[model samples]
Target chain A: MAKSKKNPLRWVRLDNAAKIYPAAMRKNWSNIYRQSMTLYEEIDTVVLKSALEVTVKRFPSIAARLRRGAFWFYLQQVEAAPEIQEEKSHPLCYMSEKEMSKYAFRVIAYRNRIAVEFFHSLTDGTGALIFLKNLVAEYLEQKHNISIPFEQGIIDRRVPPKSEELEDSFLKYAGRVPASRRDTNAWRVPGEKEPEGFIHVTCFKADVDSAIALAHKYGCTLTVFFSAVMMQALMNYQKELNPNTAKHKPIKLLIPINLRTLFKSETLRNFAMFTVPEIDARLGEYSFEEICKAVYHKMGYELTQKHMSAVIAKNVNDEKNILLRLVPLPLKNIVMKAVFDRSGERKSCLSMSNLGVVRLPEIMQKYVSRVDFILGVQATAPYNCGFLSYNGKVYINLTRNIRDAGLERHFFEILRDMGLEVTVESNRN
Target chain B: MYCVKCGVKLEDTEKICPLCETEVYHPIVKQEQVPPNYPPDKRPPAKKKTKIINGVVLFLIFIPLLTSLISDLQPDGAINWFGYVAGALTLAYIAFGLPMWFKRPNPAIFVPCFFAATVAYLKYIDFVTDGDWFLSFAFPAAMYFCLIISTLATLLFYLKRGKLYIWGGFVIALGFFFPLIELLLSLTFDLRFIGWSAYPFVVFGLLGGVLIYLAANRFARDAVQRRLFF
Candidate 1:
């Protein structure tokens, strides 16, 4: 049954499998593909404590799933009466330092700041970004024991994507790139020699408007500029590793494109696909004009609706191969190995994901401190960077999971040379 | 006692409750009541659907194996292990994955159906080749390692949920446990078969124990759970 129209739209998870992974949070980004959202505003710790009181007063829905036959399924929920329990945890919430990663999506907070992540089915990033921002914004504004503005509590509930949008977008974007047997011949292939463990870096509060102006001046979106800058740094690092590396031919880059607008769905799982463009390392050193043009043209072609449809078809049909479905148990592992090897040959030298522009009220900024994004790279992301914009500012979260530490330093140096003074954020995690 | 579904009481005089009329076991001299509906009941039959679907899934699963087998089948060399792999998955889907949809489901039917499938695959290999190695070596060895643990786990869960499942779980647990034990002993000290038909008495014992327990127990009338969800 459809929910009461009077009830404000809130987050709804699609499944636990999607919620269990950290990647689900990073890629919650949607773009021209799909962009569905809902928002809650003017809620602070005092008000939030009160809002939870009101919010949880509603009925709770739970999903149960069984793994091993003898193991029974368990129940979980997105919303429930918090007063009935001491704490609540969501599926996506994680602690990297913990073993087994027995993670939950919800987190409890009677006081202090809070951020929430949802798989697209629950709420698109835009909705979550806004919800979290205003949640904190309203939380801080109330901290001073001050009077509230009437409109601050206002919320805008966007309509869920239609079934037709879901069907169309799913037909376009439900594509999975099979594990390739060939190494993705990216600019530089990672090896045992690269580093001890993958490298991770975060830079926050970088004057986002200036970066936007710089990006606009160069005729590119902030995402494009940041991506270009990341690649430029990686290219310089590669040159340092081996002088001959940079002088070699251009490298290919992989960027994730959300197909939200193309196809809409109230359910969220994997709704994005990869767009890999072969970029010349030389392009990073060229004028911003050259870099911007290349990025725009590449994204234009790779993120198109038609091509995405083709990809979806290929993903479905590819899995039907009898070799994959009927391989002997003993030999199934062998086949998977071949697929993985091929993937290395096709790996992207660098990958950039821009969560796009996030807008927030001025009041929320004080309590939020800042927002951060991190990409999972078993090692060697080619060059990996995540850009999330909030309050007209962008936070560039980078990790060289597969590259050497030298590469990270080179990236920052190149940013400086590009006439951008980048202030690096201290790593908290 | 009251009917579990509708809660109408059955009387000593009536064959079944007149209001809740399901088949009654007592007097009325075993004369059958009029079967609820007239000439035809149109809830839809599952046989045709289950058979067709089972056939289709079997075909879908087998096509790949057939190809792999055709591509790799040999006289006495490199047996098409891929066929065995495909065959195992086919067995899994056909046996465990397909039953939940039926209006009526009986574990009595499902358990033995899979039990036969497991034994038949082993026989197929040995029959085509006439070597006892597949059964003598792998059967017991594998049973001891995997089935023993799985059976124990199943029993633990049974204790947690309810003892009502013992009619099925108890018999199957033995079918798995004895062979596994024999297999382990044969490998350790060495023995002959323990000989085929060695567990006839054991099977009888398991069956008798369970039957006695069930015969003494009375089932409480309770509402059956049902739901229709995608």
Candidate 2:
């Protein structure tokens, strides 16, 4: 049935993974990520705005603003869609607290590209990609006067949103046993920070087939291959700073895993957790092959249905605690902030999020030239990497708040040495 | 084009390699007409509407000032007690509201102006009451308080390091200042020295000594920082 336009405003409690974002966020910094698609032609703002109005009606959970209650933070449906904005000089600008309360996500257009930046509290990468695909589908249909099929990640805007799509899947799938939340502190890359909170993003475009072949040669998936290379780069960079091997710390990378792939769920909210794969540098220096092997086995051991459920149970059970539920939101924020500072970004030197291959219908694919995924740097950590494969090419985006490009240089040099051709572009002058 | 240093392919829009900062130079192959990845127009986000809120606050403050003026003048043809209310309101606005007009109000400038206005307010009160205490008691007292506060504000605002030392010195100075205040009262009003300033002097002196010690010892500072790590 078609939903009434004047229906009462709906609100939902933040999902298990999302609850910490509101508390962990600062006045100038928030957990935000951007996904953009470049088309063959320039974008018309009027048509994009109208398309957003229609697309938002279909995704109630995504089209809402963050609100605070006495006990928890919730997402309330906005009366109208936020205005379409012009793209800034860079993607993922600092989203202040007031801006998040007004709108948790923004649609930006520049030249022939359309980008959507989302506050991580609103959704994970999978959910954000789905939202972006649907929005692009709507924009194409309106601008080109061609109907797009509701296949792949695109959704039908005419249909009402299903209850399952807005569900907190973690609450439903958590197991009885909670996982042990223990992790060792990792080595952090230190550098001079950019003044005035400027973020630098560098994107490397490579042939996906060749990269996949290299991964196959290493007997591992593309994510594991990249993780190993990242670890090696970090190790090399740290070794230069501290020549003594005995003083070295562990190198860890937090890889975010999409839970929908393991569990049977169709929700668009946050259903993702992370696994930290680390290497102890105190033992000895590792070769490229050794790092790859270690990362592959660690991913295999952690990315399991049983272990994922245990992690979910640990998070959900904390939310279910009666004493925790009764704590006021202000007090909860302080506790969560302290806990986050202690164990959140401290366990991982950086995050590597791979969205895998993105497939669009043939009709929709003709107009889209390329797609890019960019993750914002962590709260305390300086670097983050996000990548996605689309249309025979993989776009790997490295974002940092620091001025030194040693990590990027080392990373790309490794890929170049491996016989992979990388095309580099950046927002820097 | 390729980066001469890193050997990675560079886009036409890139003048330098993002990874290594190497200049891209190709004599035969000219730069293409392709647009850059991000937009050239780097528009910053709009600032908040602080001026509007400041204006609203100004209007709110004006309400009572005008009301008191009218109420004081209605009973007679001349301004009677309106000066006292106006002086207090003006002092309050100068201390609080004046800073709102600036985006980054410097304490070095505002602090002195606030204390000067405070002294003026006291002078006004003395003038209206026809008291003989303006030059000897009120002026010196206000100037002394102003000098201490102004120096503290200026030092704290300008100096980035040695905060603990500055605070320690400030507290110790404040401890001695109480006795001076008591001495002034005794000279002006012919009152006996009760030695009441000794209590505050003792407390502030001990606190200032500890702060200075912590400032000198790096180990103690680090320990305090770790324990109070928010």
Error of 1 at B75 (Å): 68
- The reply for model 1, stretches above 4 Å from the true place, is A1-184, A188-199, A246-250, A264-267, A281-288, A319-341, A344-346, A361-369, A379-383, A400-404, B1-230
lDDT of 2 by residue, A1-429 (tens): 123357677778899999999999985579999999899999999999999999888888887789899999988777788999977667888988788788899999998999999989888999889989999999999999998887898877899888889999999999889999988999989987775577889998999999999999999999999999899999988888887888999999999999999999999999999989889888998998999989898889988999999999999999999999999999999999989889898999999999999999899899999999999988888999999999999999999988789999989889989999989899975
List-wise, what DockQ does each model earn? 0.00, 0.30
- List native contact recovery per candidate, as a fraction of 1: 0.00, 0.72
Candidate 1 docking DockQ:
0.00
TM-score of each: 0.44, 0.71
Model 1 chain B weakest 10-residue run by lDDT: B220-229
Instruction: Tell me the tens digit of each residue's lDDT in model 1 across A284-397.
Output: 455546666777788877676667766766654544556554654335434444544456324666567777765444443443444555443422243356667665556665
Cα deviation of B166, candidate 1, in Å? 89
Point to the candidate with the largest lDDT: 2
